[model samples]
Target: MKKFVLVGVVAVCVIIAALIGTRMLTPPPAELDLARSKTSVNGTYLASIEPETEPVSVGPVHNWVLTLASADSTPAAGVTIEVDGGMPDHGHGLPTEPQVSRELGDGRYLVEGVRFNMGGWWELTFQIESDVGSDSVTFNLML
Candidate 1:
């Protein structure tokens, strides 16, 4: 009877551990209704970077969720915007690569996951290319 009880307890523990591990491995789904600029890239539009808050020093990791708005105040959809300069000087350390966000097809771009390995201001002058003329804008982000 003692041996059977101990084995039962171990089995329960193993099952509980498996369930906990599965839950931990699961990642939260990406938000579909994400925040975005209320503007699209147009000729009469002015592109600028507005920091949501003051930059703080976190580890070597930080993320930025940016939205490209148009002059008419709508999310810029299906538009490819490029940042030339990187980091906080132009934007946040130009993460060595331009963060590409998937277009939700509703005139909004979603830059879901951005990881900055350093802390500083990345200066980036970006240009938007589309069927319309390229619109250049500057972003100064702090990481």
Candidate 2:
């Protein structure tokens, strides 16, 4: 009887551990309704980068979401937007490779894995390309 009870306890413990691991691996939900903070890239198209949280600080990881649209306010869906950011004064890019992990429709792209090691003047450049055309925009942030 003691052996059976011990086996059952171990099995239960394993199941609980598995459940916790699965939860930790789960990705957080995307921010779909972020506000559009515009950055003009030659006035040909309208693009915006909205941070998942407001008042973006220094020395912390953040996910900066993007929304690209035409001048007439149409979402530039199916367009590919590449994100690269660095501190110009310091002469180094972000510590992590920030990427557009997923497209949340309506010209929305989720940029993940962004971390600023130190605070200063940072320039985030977005390379936008699609059937419409290709252009680049840079946003200067002073943390």
Candidate 3:
């Protein structure tokens, strides 16, 4: 019985080591662009995000401000934006369903209920629709 217990402990330690090793080996993409502003996938609009809180932390919901502008640098108003995101590496969605709660005018929208449960590579995608066109932009965050 004692021998069996010792073997089990060794196995568990090996598994833990392997898990940690894997995580350390596969870091976020080297070229991961962490820019707050980026152009939409279809080149229809330019979107930028600013977290309400400085130095975002895990746990506790927060808010973000999203600004939309045309490719020519004109503020895009009266637009509808949808938010969706998760940790790409973890293969899970965000703990909270963030949404565009209100428009702050001048092409800025208020995003509410943004939360990061874990520290890793996270993606926040915004699907924007306006009179000009419909497009999507994704931003990466590492917490």
Candidate 4:
């Protein structure tokens, strides 16, 4: 009985190690050009905000994918990006503070916690900071 218990413990440890190794070795998500052109100041960079969820209605959280690229079509990796926006006509900001959750590598990021309380000409702005410089772009969303 004791021998069986010891073997089980060893098996568990081995399984855990394998899982960790798999995660460490796995590559990040591929960058995709999934949305319209949203460019930074003076066309120094390009950004696109693609909604992952369809029928992006109001009052429900949504997932957005942000893709950044340089003017020369290079991936803008290892950069700090900020997201914020709201109804400009209504003079208010987003109900929740949206943020970049995952760095998918190669200028691709997963932005989560996006909720539009009441949608009517909403603007989603992205501020990017990288080695080149810092600039911002906005996406006008109509719902």
TM-score of each: 0.44, 0.69, 0.83, 0.73
Residue by residue across 1-143, what tens digits does model 3's lDDT show? 99999999999999999987787557799899999999999999888999998999998899999999999989999999889999877678899999998989888999999999988899999999989999999999999
Order candidates by lDDT, high to low: 3, 4, 2, 1
lDDT per residue for candidate 1 within 38-134, as digits (tens), equals 2223454444343323353433333344455556656566678664564322232444555545554544444433345555443445567655456
Off by over 4 Å in 4: 1-35
Candidate 4 or 1, higher lDDT: 4
- Candidates 3 and 4, the one with greater TM-score: 3
Clashes of each: 24, 0, 0, 0
- For model 4, residues 1-143, the per-residue Cα lDDT tens digits are 99999999999999999887776444333342223566786686888777897878998898898999988889998888899988656667999999999889888999999999874567788888998679988877766
Highest TM-score model number:
3
- Pairs in steric clash, model 4: none
**Alpha-carbon runs more than 4 Å astray in model 1:** 1-63, 87-95, 112-117
Q: State the displacement of the C-alpha of residue 139, model 3, in Å, after optimal TM-score superposition.
A: 0.1
The segments of candidate 3 whose C-alpha lies over 4 angstroms from its true place after superposition are 1-25
What TM-score does candidate 2 get on C-alpha atoms?
Answer: 0.69
